[model samples]
Target: MKSFRLFLIASLIFITNNFLFSQEEDVVEDSTETLEVYLIDNYLQGENEKILVLSWMTNLPTKSKVKIEEIGTFNVSDTLTDFHQTKIDLSNVRFTKNEYMFKIISELEDGSSVESEEYSFLVPFEEKDTSSTKSTTTSQQVKTSSSYYIYNFALGITLWLLPSPALAFENNKTKFAILKDLPLVSIGSFSAYKTFPYVYFYAGYVHIPEGFVKNSFRLGTKYLYELPEIKHFVSLGLGGFTNFKGSNGINGEIGFSFLKVLKTFEMTASYSYNYLPSSKNKFHLFSIGLFTSSFSINLNY
Candidate 1:
């Protein structure tokens, strides 16, 4: 009995020691500082003296600075933020080397710091033949412009090919609706512009199952302010409507739409206020359907 008790006590002690060690390891891992930074985009900008534009985002809210080897460190943000975009002037720095290595250092209020992996950028070399360079650049710009229009054309053909359904309300009357969008044209460059002017044709039908089962048809033109990052749009529309039971009249509408990006097509939820001048009628409309435009509109300008 004494020997058995000794073995049991030793086994319990061994299990307890392992459990305590595991707990300590967990604590250490949890307390470790972690921060990650990602590069969004970069470019060179200037009319006379060029500047390097570096934009990056962090996983955590931190006051961050970027350190370039040979060149001095540049401050990015004074307050803690997850997004950081800054322009670093390279006018004074001598480009003795072709490339330079840089890293992002992020520090929290508690003085805990973390660093990103080293990144490098190459300096752009100047062209010798100015006349040839200008001609080449002009040709490239023309090709880019053509590609932009072609892309939007293909997108219009594929995405807005089908008309979807919606729910509409007018004068406290609810009706089932069929909606279609014919995108006329879109104007903006993907890289340089944040907002795009979109012109499209809008058509819809409201079906009412009363008396003779009246059908109301509306045809309109819509002008929209498209915001790509926020995935939303604001629109103004003017059209004429004809009812099988009532008289024809002119109507105006203001609409707001939210866009959801999907693999094949973008889904849209829209709300609008509509007014008719002839009948003195006012209505609110809500629609949920696929949009003719993508949330990420590819452009070059």
Candidate 2:
């Protein structure tokens, strides 16, 4: 009887140990399965809002808990399963000129935890506005400040100093001869403000140089409407260019410009047709060319 009792006790102990081992193994397997999460936001811009999403998968029958934080601040915390969507308000988020970054975290029912790699995106900002504005009053005031006058003056001077069509025609004998007999040189300056998508205005001086000495001028204003693609611009201006020496007047033109931006360069092709007054010689001036062999660099603020 003693031996039988001892054998029975040994059998019970063996069965109990096996059951405990099996339970622990099941728990380990459950913990190994974790949830996955990610963020989605591209082309974020100023005063615009965006949404961030979190997603996961689980085989367990129990509900799982998911939590999210941004830069150590709790943005979202909830019990979730299968899928979850969250909307983040980015209206006040201050993004750097070119890039933005965010972080996310997730947890599963079996006490398993997982983290996502930092996600980043690139966005381009309008550099000219930030560099040109610095005041609390009207935009016109900011634009007309003394600093702006100095900046534009310096820019114009620099252009005159550099090698341009004007300079090239004046110095080279071959170019001078070609331009001297041409009898017309058109000059224009334009300023555009892109405050919204698919809309902008251009304002500046449009002049035509006429006469043997190239001392004549034409003053005019042009209204331009750009297409949605931003690759094409059409303009109409009403003005007159005078050949003071000859007492002749040349009517203004309706012009169009097409532009293509490459990785390191920009190309522009333009055309204009002039309508002469009945008193002057009725003729047309047409031009087509490309701005190439030049480098384009973008600076951000």
Candidate 3:
């Protein structure tokens, strides 16, 4: 009876070992299986404000990212999902009329990744006026042909506010800046403009102080004309200033704009004459600054 018991115990141990070995083999096989993620459909869409939308469907749920040719990879989905949609903000994109190659990569749960076939599309033509014409190219027209207005806002850092005791570009006893803590003077300005094909109508406000002049507030309007193809502009403006001291004046300005640096940043210089007829005092102001309109939006008619 003891011998029989020993035989039964040995048989049980062998059976248990075989069972464990089979489970290990099954797990290894499952892990080594091929990843079968694939795209069922994929397409790109265009929107206003230079936005590009990409949408795709995968056969299996998986995390995915899109890889654009010039741009880097952008995440489309973090969690497992078969459907993916992502918007690419290309307002800052510098290249125009260039083709971009892109692909989607999906990562599966089994530590393997699959990539969809490559696709290509061209950027809208730079010279093509989306506001006035239709595009037959791959890029879609964001606005209708009837749309004739483009709205923009600009904020500038005044490098020098030279309230010269005389004319344009003349040096003064006191100069002000938005960045520096110069004595008795600091300056800031913001403006909004609406553009037609070649002209701009603008309104702006300026902040002054007693140190510069008693008025402390300057409001204005400008009529600007673009110099064809050269990326330069000139403007004439008329406005007024008033403050608590009951001191007030009417101001007029002549301004020039340099080319838009990198299609975003702009440099401007202007000269203004402030005449306080009541006080019989006149001030000449010249300013140079860098301006940006990264947040500017174009309004369509």
The number of the candidate with the highest lDDT is 1
The worst-scoring run of ten residues by lDDT in candidate 2 lies at 174-183
How many clashing residue pairs are found in candidate 2?
A: 0
Per-residue lDDT tens digits of candidate 2, residues 1-301? 9999999999999999999999999999986744444333333333235333333333332233323223233435466443333454555544435555654555556555555566664544334456567533211111357988788667644433332122112122222111111102222222122211221222122223441234334544444455547655565655555446654454454656565533311222333333335443333333332222111121111
Q: What would the TM-scores of all predictions be?
A: 0.47, 0.29, 0.36
Clashes of 1: 0
Candidate 1: residue 241 Cα off by (Å): 22
Model 2: CA > 4 A from native? 1-215, 246-250, 261-279, 289-301
- Give the per-residue Cα lDDT of candidate 1 at 248: 63
Tell me the whole-model lDDT of each prediction, alpha carbons only: 0.66, 0.40, 0.57
* Candidate 2 residue pairs in backbone clash: none
TM-score of 2: 0.29
Prediction-by-prediction clash tally: 0, 0, 0
